[model samples]
Target: MSHLHRAIAFTATLLAAGLLQAGQVRVAVAANMAIPMQRIAVEFERATGHELIPALGSTGRFYSQLRGGAPFEVLLAADDEIPARLEREGLAVPGSRFTYAVGRLVLWSLDPHGVDPQGNVLKQLPRGRLAIADPRLSPYGAAAIKTLGGLGVLAAWQPAFLQGESVSQAFQFVASGNASYGFLALSQVMRDGRIPRGSGWIVPSQYHPPLNQDVVLLNGGRSSAAALAFLDYLKSEPARATLRGFGYEVVKH
Candidate 1:
């Protein structure tokens, strides 16, 4: 074979190798999105041939990591504001941010009678433990505090509260009976709009600001094609339907 023919063959091999190596996208996601994001990642990998590496935590912690040079290509955060800030700071790719899901807070309990959907349960439980994510750090925790205040129970329930570092941990606290009851994401308690295990109350939307979960491509200046693709997939009709089925509200805008 001529020298040119051998060179062409070698280049073809290198291109194939590069394609194989580009089949993964590292993602940093909020802990509250763990379960749903796992399901979405599975489908995304199947559809796009890109493996998702998710690092889940509170939005505040993840933001710090991203700023500290964590090698992440995507962020699925618990709120839209963080993504907006990242975009404004040029840490995230502009025009790549979009709302993925609207989170809902629920009062949940492992105890059969610890929660009542139609009753003011907090007023009845004078000293019962109420688990919540730390409002100083977690967005869900902030919402929980706001909701409690809105309902006129913040001061009365302050002494009975147990705080978790992340929303997932807060839910686990209640689920394991470490606390008699707790605030959690509605999606954590419901499947197909029905609560499966212990009792829960879906707090009225009017009680707190919307929990708008957002996704954005980090400006890692790497091959974020797959990351951007997955962001688009999250807004696809089928994906939105699946999220809604899991009790997450689909963002209209």
Candidate 2:
């Protein structure tokens, strides 16, 4: 064989090896996590040469979709429960779930003075629509309900509530003036480690159950190297830093 032919065959073998090592990971992400996850996704791809395909929405909705056989390879949920449930249902890889971030709830308004630091605005809440996620679907929405109930305002506020299917949608309600105030994930309204240009009350953690966001590798990803690599990347320093920047609490391993 000619020397050029041997060189070409070696180059083709190397290219095939590179293709075999890279893959795509399909992930279902909670709505509140959309922004930060986008930042992490860019980093992950650059570092690992893998593509991350993310579908963002409420964790509860994702659970329903998963049960109906959605082709997602990983789930980044707003709460730990649904992921655990998926494990019990044999849909997720056992022993592959972990808490990625603990989220904080916030009562936000576009008006700079709309919400008070102590969240006292709820006491004599202005006569306008109050937005919250539907407690049936979002953990943040459930936290909002618990906060209102703890503050003795749930019953009175129900009359003026505007419910969204996910926390992101709830934030949109306030941002678009469809509602004057809304319950949202701190991450949704935060920028550069703080709430910029808006008024918000960071709901005291004691007001509701801890928002332990969990991520799990699903059965669909059991054989995907990219899926596993993404999970490991999520726990790395760069990813955790992004989570913290968005107002999430990351537990050190």
Candidate 3:
């Protein structure tokens, strides 16, 4: 081959390699989404040759970070309202928001067959501690509070409660037997619909407002091709199936 032609071919190959290497996305996610998001991140990296750096925390805390100029490309929040607010404030890309999952609350206990899903399980507890995330700072905690109120068990069960900073922490509290029963996400309790090492009651969706999980591409992430690709992957059929497998409800809208 001619020297010029060889040089041109080598340059083309380098460009292709660079394109293929464009696979790193940074994401800020709500702590409740940790497990499912980790699973999805692996699948995404396999399918698209991308790496995901996920920062998990309370939705409120993440919002504070984003507002304070944290270097995140995307935000996976517990509620759509926060993403909408970010968009309105020019922190997120306009029209780049979508609901990813409808979260479910569960009343979980460490002992097998410990919880009674029927009604007023709190009244039957044998002096064991109950754990709940703090309602003022965590969305899942707020939902739990609302569910308790709706079930007419709030006032009766107040003294038995132990508070966690976040839903995942609350789950940990129950899992470690620090609390006998705790409010947790259904995804946290169910391993293919059956509970893992503990008994849990899948709270009916009607009892509380829908736990809509939303994702948005931040304005800073717009220039990140990998970030955009990861956002698209979250809505893909395989991703949706994985989320459903983990007991999260996939929203069509």
lDDT of 2 by residue, 1-253 (tens): 5432343345345434774466789999999998998898999888778899999999999999999999999999999999999999999988788899999999999999999999999999567899999899999999999999999999889999999999889988999999999999999988879998779999999999999999998999876778877777787899999899999999975
In candidate 1, position 74 carries an lDDT of 87
List the pairs of residues colliding in candidate 3: none
lDDT score of residue 168 within candidate 3: 82
Model 2 worst lDDT window (10 residues) = 3-12
The runs of at least 3 residues in candidate 1 whose Cα sits more than 4 Å from the true structure, single-residue gaps closed, are: 1-22
Residue pairs whose backbone atoms clash in candidate 2? none
For each candidate, what TM-score against the reference? 0.88, 0.91, 0.89
- What RMSD, rounded to one decimal, does every model reach? 7.5, 7.8, 7.3
Best by TM-score: 2
Q: Write the per-residue lDDT of candidate 1 for residues 24-62, one digit (tens) a residue.
A: 678888888888877888887776666888888888888
Index of the highest-lDDT prediction? 2
lDDT of 3 by residue, 1-253 (tens): 6432343345345434774455587899887888888788889888777799998788888888899999999999988789999999999987788899988888888887778766457655346888888887678899889988887778878888899888888988888879988988888777665666777788888888899999988978776667767776787799999889878999774
The lDDT, on a scale of 0 to 1, for candidate 2 is 0.89
Give the candidates in order of TM-score, highest first. Answer: 2, 3, 1
**lDDT, model 3, position 238:** 92
